[model samples]
Target: MAATGGSGRSTVADLLAAGMAADGASAVVLDTAPRLTSPWPSWTVGQEAEGLAALPPDRPLTRSHVRHAAALRPGADRPDWHVLTDGRDWHSPPLTLPQAPAAWLQLAAIGGWQCVVADTPHPVTHDLLQSRCAGHIGLTRSWCELPYAVPVLCASATAGGVQALQQAVMALHAEGMPLQRTVAVLVAQTDGRLPAVARAGATMLSARIAAVVHIPHDPHIRAHGLRTVTRLRSRTRHAAGLLFHEVLAAAGASWGTPLPDAPRPAPLAVVSHS
Candidate 1:
């Protein structure tokens, strides 16, 4: 009965929801800005400025606004603030993670009390997965996942491409992105690019990350991808649960908590994502 935190849009939320469902718990998703912000189509310059003004002072918000606001700097095209609040004259300061109900919900949902929390701030969709380890709850020592945040330079691929991917990951890491956030990378298999990514990732992120999966490229395989997507999604989720259990076991070894090996859950359907 412990809680953990994660940061993201749909990806983290989706995975968290799946985890909550699997564990029969609840998930409270927090947005970076007020929920009443403008829709995607209305995300123009003036529109965003207006949207910022329209943000609610106390409601949860998404990080999109902050990222966008930062983008509007001298050489930027937009701003990047999760939620914009009124200045000196406003009723409240601004919305932030601490103000969001998700934190409390996670605490209540897990053990009926506060326990653990995780977050990552990368803009392209990525987060730290380490903070979710089950055994670290209420522990005095916190495990850092720095290597997982580093890029394992691949020789087969263009330095620029690998660098870009690495930059994206680093951005997420520096931004305090959640650990469970999944990153998508395009690799040239014949060139050993996948291995490079894995090797580098393993070397740099071994302590924080669990495993690196290589998904084959198959164009025709996507014909019925939605179903497969659903299945693979389930598989990854179960894998996460397994990871949680492993953490618990490790923690038990030192804390005398007497962790038990939970029964393996049924395999999820595998779908082709070409």
Candidate 2:
């Protein structure tokens, strides 16, 4: 997942990981952001940091090294998923651009993980963007960042935000990014009913993008740190499920069959022009 900055890309990555795990897919999140915040803090102990410290700077990372760096959180409703982070506060020995692809390959080789979500920094440098991942999810709080072609999830929380999303879609088309790979996610950041402009923006976005999902603001998600979707409110979980499904589809992933215990969100009503 790539975000310009503070667009809650980490949160989206976490939700996607949880959703995949719930669906019986072994998932792992790779934190490539400069600021080493663990998306799965609920499971990571200090040992994760120690594992990072032990990594050799000179050699290519191996599956064993990745396992060593992997942190697990137990006792969730689903099987435990792993998170691989740099495990340090500062980006001292950062993963160089050349090393990123190798690191991703090593993680893929770790075996049994069906999905790997990466939370990356702004502009998503060319090297990382070209890596062999399923697809990309670009998050932006503002519409100004929507010109690229990769699939995107925009968070519209206000009237201006809505307008920005509409304009961004036009800019995206002008830039040659297919609207079929784009998505606009309506995030109700406030408690009151959604603004009319936001609703209209969602309608317009639905006409252009593959899907549009509305995620009502949930205090539980905001206050609670790093928890499963099961712990979220019904509406929040439902919206997350819809977004997850669309994301996987855009990535060309075979969702296979849903697990019996998996929480599946109802599909959002979309207004498509096509």
Highest TM-score: which candidate?
2
What candidate 1 gets wrong by more than 4 Å, as runs, is 1-9, 32-195, 207-234, 243-274
Tens digits of per-residue lDDT for model 2, 143-237: 22321212555554677666655665665565445567565666677777788888777876787777776767778767775554446666665
Q: In model 2, where is the ten-residue run with the lowest total lDDT?
A: 140-149
lDDT of every predicted structure (CA atoms)? 0.30, 0.55
What's the distance in Å from true for residue 52, model 1? 17
Q: Report the CA-based lDDT of candidate 2 relative to the real structure.
A: 0.55
lDDT (10s digit) by residue, model 1, range 1-274: 0011111122322233334334433222222333333121122223333333343344433344323332111101111112122222234444443333343222223222111223222223122234234433211111123211211111112344345545545544554543332323222323223545545643554344332233332232224321122334334445434433333343444334543332222333555578
Error of 2 at 108 (Å): 3.6
Cα RMSD of all models vs. native, in order, equals 16.7, 12.0
Distance from true position, residue 199, model 1, in Å? 4.0
lDDT against true structure, model 1: 0.30
- Summing lDDT over every window of 10 consecutive residues in candidate 1, give the lowest-scoring window: 71-80
Q: Could you tell me the lDDT of residue 257 within candidate 2?
A: 36
